[model samples]
Target: MIRFEQVSKSYSGGVQALQKISFHIQPGEMAFLTGHSGAGKSTLLKLISIMERPSAGHVFINGHDLSKVNRKQIPFVRRDIGMIFQNHRLLRDNTIFDNVALPLVIEGYGLKAIRKRVETALDKVGLLDKARYYPNMLSGGEQQRVGIARAVVNTPPILLADEPTGNLDPKLSLEIMRLFEDFNSVGTSVLIATHDLGLIARMKYRTLTLTRGRMVQDGLEASGANGVES
Candidate 1:
């Protein structure tokens, strides 16, 4: 559902984040993006979400050309994409339910609909019992689960996670990955940018590897010896 054709991104001061990178992620696919620090994983995700425009080439989300989508259309495009980050980006002052409800609230859903959707999303992430709790009241892993719940509250067609399990313990990381797999099994396209090669190996999904801002590998079962620094 996501495609990048001959994409290149360059920043000020001669920084090249990506160079002629291209890939296609089909509907219902789950893939891992691997690379060292500054390999442009986040930059690529931003392009797909229309948060940052590519310096060159075209980015297609679902079927819409992102370059052609105007400012007024970004929110509509993002409605079909859910994003999760490494930091769990929760509001400390808000309860879990409120945090998860933010998207539907912004979409103008009524209280009843928001309540239903938030509860369902929290339940899916095994956080139904903690909906009333604040972020500080939960463990690191639980907080991450809350972030996942918030991202999927709208049941978006695509899920993009950046270093999602970066801070969790091995067990908790595995649990988090399983959650992604569950969502993917039900047909949500998933693309995760992670540094955990062991986890990637265990999951055995298609992986896209980047090095120095170029796509070096895009195939099934990335080898441990692929020479990816991350």
Candidate 2:
């Protein structure tokens, strides 16, 4: 779960990226966050991941107030969250298996444990067969799948994705969304920030709309899980 209480963020250059934002994402929920470029969508995700902090107001992630989060505890806070970028930030030097296994390796898990979890994560993304391939050897979709695998290898409670489907085709985008839904089905909170309106229209999850750094909407649509609202 994540909560933002009247949060606002401004860069050092005096650019205000978010303003008075407030919302709550419950556990086991998957939602789309839609907005144009510079609408504060990325800023919001960064706040949850603690990559950036708000200049005002408070941010609480899974019940810990980030305003009170100490330097020593930032890593622990991040341990409970996972994130995917549009660029599929995989290591070029590592194979798919190594990429997904990186987190567990950093956590100092045993080889047997790392293998079990990495394979499971790769399986969840339907990329287990490609585990031996390097990132450069894969297509955009495959690379993104590897990115998703890395994000979930630790079984984090929340997943933050920024424009995950931006580079994929319609069909592939749907496949990626389906994978995300499967993860949410088992209790991982997912918040995806995207500008692809066409794809978003097909994902009927509760969506929070933002414009000009303001949150404009957050609720369910009448048309079940594939509804769209402009």
Leading candidate by TM-score: 1
Q: How does model 1 score by TM-score?
A: 0.97
Task: Give a tens-digit lDDT track for model 2, residues 21-54.
Answer: 9999999989988877888899999988788989
Q: What is the lDDT of candidate 2?
A: 0.87
Q: Candidate 2 at 60: error in angstroms?
A: 0.6
Q: lDDT scores for all predictions?
A: 0.92, 0.87
Residue 72 lDDT in candidate 1: 98
How high is the lDDT of residue 9 in model 1? 96
lDDT assessment of candidate 1: 0.92
Locate the minimum summed-lDDT window of 10 residues in model 1.
Answer: 221-230
List the candidate 2 regions with Cα displacement exceeding 4 Å: 221-230
Instruction: Give the number of colliding residue pairs in candidate 2.
Output: 1
lDDT (C-alpha) at residue 2 in model 2: 92
Model 1 regions more than 4 Å off:
224-226
Best by lDDT: 1
